[model samples]
Target: MQFLDTINFSVPLLANATETVDSSMVIKSVLLSLVVIYFVSKLGGELSNKVGLPPVLGELLGGVVIGISILHLLVFPEGSTDSSSSLIMNFLQTTAGLTPEATPQVFAAQSEVISVLAELGVIILLFEIGLESNLKELMAVGIQASVVAVVGVVVPFGAGTIGLMTLFGISAVPAIFAGAALTATSIGITSKVLSEIGKLNSKEGQIILGAAVIDDILGIIVLAVVASLAKDGEVDINKVIYLIVSATGFLLGAIVLGNIFNQTFVAIADKLKTRGGLVIPAFIFAFIMAYLAAVIQLEAILGAFAAGLVLEETDKRKELQRQVIPIADMLVPIFFVTVGAKTDLGVLNPTIPSNREGLIMATFLIAVAIIGKVVTGLTVFGQPGINRLAIGIGMIPRGEVGLVFAGVGAASGALSKPLGAAIVMMVILTTFLAPPLLRFVFPDETTTATLEAASGTSLVIESDVITLTDSQENELKS
Candidate 1:
């Protein structure tokens, strides 16, 4: 199979010698960028792991070190389209006027292509997240999880909106986008920590995981609404309602219809003896959903998420997930590194009074983010046997999803560069801090079963529902 096709040059060249030469240069530039980005990103991930931080933090930092914001080493045609430097830039000028106003540049045409691939990386990343989610398991977690998810979304969003407006005097639309950026919880980091501590199957852990899934769904809807509002340049109540309704309906319709389609496609693919017969169709389903999502003015990741959720119910799920990972591993880092690269660190220089405002904003957002998730943990009060603080800590890390929100907002021009940088700063701080806090909250549970056994008592929340308790009511108050 031809893999890494986004960066790989496999298209047949024209018979004309000049055309072939031009294509070769383009291929070389792309290959060079990939080599540099991959190696640096890997190094960053390795370093982050060494420090007990998520590798995503390291990848993001690596991008900053090598990107235009720092070393000024990586250069892409941001607004320039010089034919001599970039064939793609030249092509864009002729076809789409991609070069803003008037500008010309060269060589980094491949960088533009890499940016597109980076976008695809995040979409695939979201799809993988969806694949990992079990709809039944999420639903079964019940009201406690729902409350946690809702509080997690609302608190940070509100904090971000009010903080940005008050601190930076930003308008409502941009402030809301900033708030949306803070609403996501990084499931990957939280799940890994839970697994390492042997708490992944615990009641609290289950609630955390379920809540994070719900958070992603809610965050995406917020992103859609905020992005639409920013694009339209006016705050129309009717438009907002339409966007909310459309996003909700699309998600429901896609899941229902996609499930039926998955069953039929799987049945047909099962009859085929060809290799990759199953995996290929599954990938196609994700791709088609992502395309359709863009058509409806929703983010492509939403479509990807739906595809993953639908296919996750099929018999081929394990194999499909296994196959999707390698692709995700290759592309996902590009997204993180690009996000890091795009971040302007100058706004974070606290020594300068002006730059200090950005730092203050970041600090405030981080507090909001951390407190928001901590509040989520407290909301699990109805669930006995679960550590409320632990659940909240688990939901604290915004990680990749936060970056996705900030990146999308920045790309859409809904967030200015400094605000975007500040958001990234908040993501970095939260991702770094959550693990140690989670460890502190849940000290020595050897196994989830052991924890469940210890929680032999129950607490009633709603009429018939029961939760296990490890602490007395007064102890919880303290």
Candidate 2:
């Protein structure tokens, strides 16, 4: 009788312990995934640099190697792999003694954490871009940029919509959504490439940056309008007006607040009496700005960008920029890797019968995607000597913005499989090709640097912070 009682008590304890262990699996999976990400990012980045391409491309390809299409090691829910399908989950099951019953729940929790990290990575990226940018120059080119943005949106959107409707016999709503996807200029991808090539401060770069910002604002409004049409078959005028007003108000308010907050921001940074004083205060402001943008139904990255712009005007811009770089380098690869990992290249294969039709449809999208944004450079009337080709090439990538549209259309049942696959193909090609194409269109600055360096003009690594050369600094002051 005593033995029976002991067994009953132990049974309950065992059940409790199982529950505890199951919950802890999420942490284990997350830890393992980070290890994989870091390894892939480092390997990819190094290889890319060796090939004279951007390190980001290498990081992205590394993710693809480890992700669903190749190794199936780092899969996500959006990529259509659940715990049962994930190699990581299988590894945990065999190695870590993870029970099949608890696997799905753990996998979900782990994926959420990674996704959040990736989102934060992008927010930080946009903030870094804004900090590197000259706000006054962005403002100076505002009129020209707006024209470029408007022209960029109208051309691709109109052309894509009309072509899809006429050629493919697609419905109005789906065509409109597809057209909307064409209008996105991934500021993240474009800005990163510009920074990598050391053209982020150029005249074309400023206009491209300015136009990209306006493009995002307009894209949001267009997305809302199209999404509504998909759902209800009619546009909500009130919602459209609200989006316009709120987006415009948020940007204007951020700029106004930047001017007002600079003095106070400096005061707070000065009073901090510990390590990370400067960067911590700066991030606090950035997070607050990000939160505000999200609260107003705007992109969090926008607020982070606005915060950076505000702080860029401060006395500590150079120090702040340097401080932020290490943090950025650490987190930014996660964003790029995840993007590559999430990409499913299987649909692009012409070996599959269904994929062949999609490939044909994709041709149209690919053409429209390239031609639409390339024309925006011609819209710049006053900026003589601007590299028009470079400016337009800078706007080519659709990146995650395109994915959002494809996902929404698929979710809403507005797009057919062929059309959706075509859209994805367009996004993948543009995103992957833009960096190389952008590098191509711009002048070979590296050769110029080499020639200059060989002509008894030595370059110096002043510090971890990027110090402009004396000539470059003089030009900036002038």
Best by TM-score: 2
Clashing pairs in 2: none
lDDT of 1 by residue, 206-323 (tens): 7887687567667766766787788887556665576567766877797578558767877977897888887788778888998877766566766776787788777667667778
Candidate 1 collision pairs: 82-104, 82-105, 85-106, 85-107, 86-106, 86-107, 384-468, 385-468, 385-469
lDDT of 2 by residue, 1-478 (tens): 0001111122122235355435467778888888898899999989987877878778888988888778877888774677786788999999999889878767776776677778788889989988898889889999989999999999999999999999989989999999999998888888888888778878899999989988988888898899899999999999899989998998899889889999998899899989999999899989999888877767888888889899988877878888999999888888888888888999889999999989998999999999999989998988778889888888999988888888878888999999999999999999998888887887555322322343568654532135654466555466
Relative to the unseen true structure, what is the C-alpha lDDT of residue 373 in candidate 1, on a scale of 0 to 100? Answer: 78
Range of the 10 consecutive residues with the lowest summed lDDT in candidate 1 = 1-10
Residue 47 CA displacement from its true place in model 2, Å: 1.3
Residue 95 in model 1: shift from native, Å?
30
| Window of ten residues with lowest summed lDDT in model 2 | 1-10
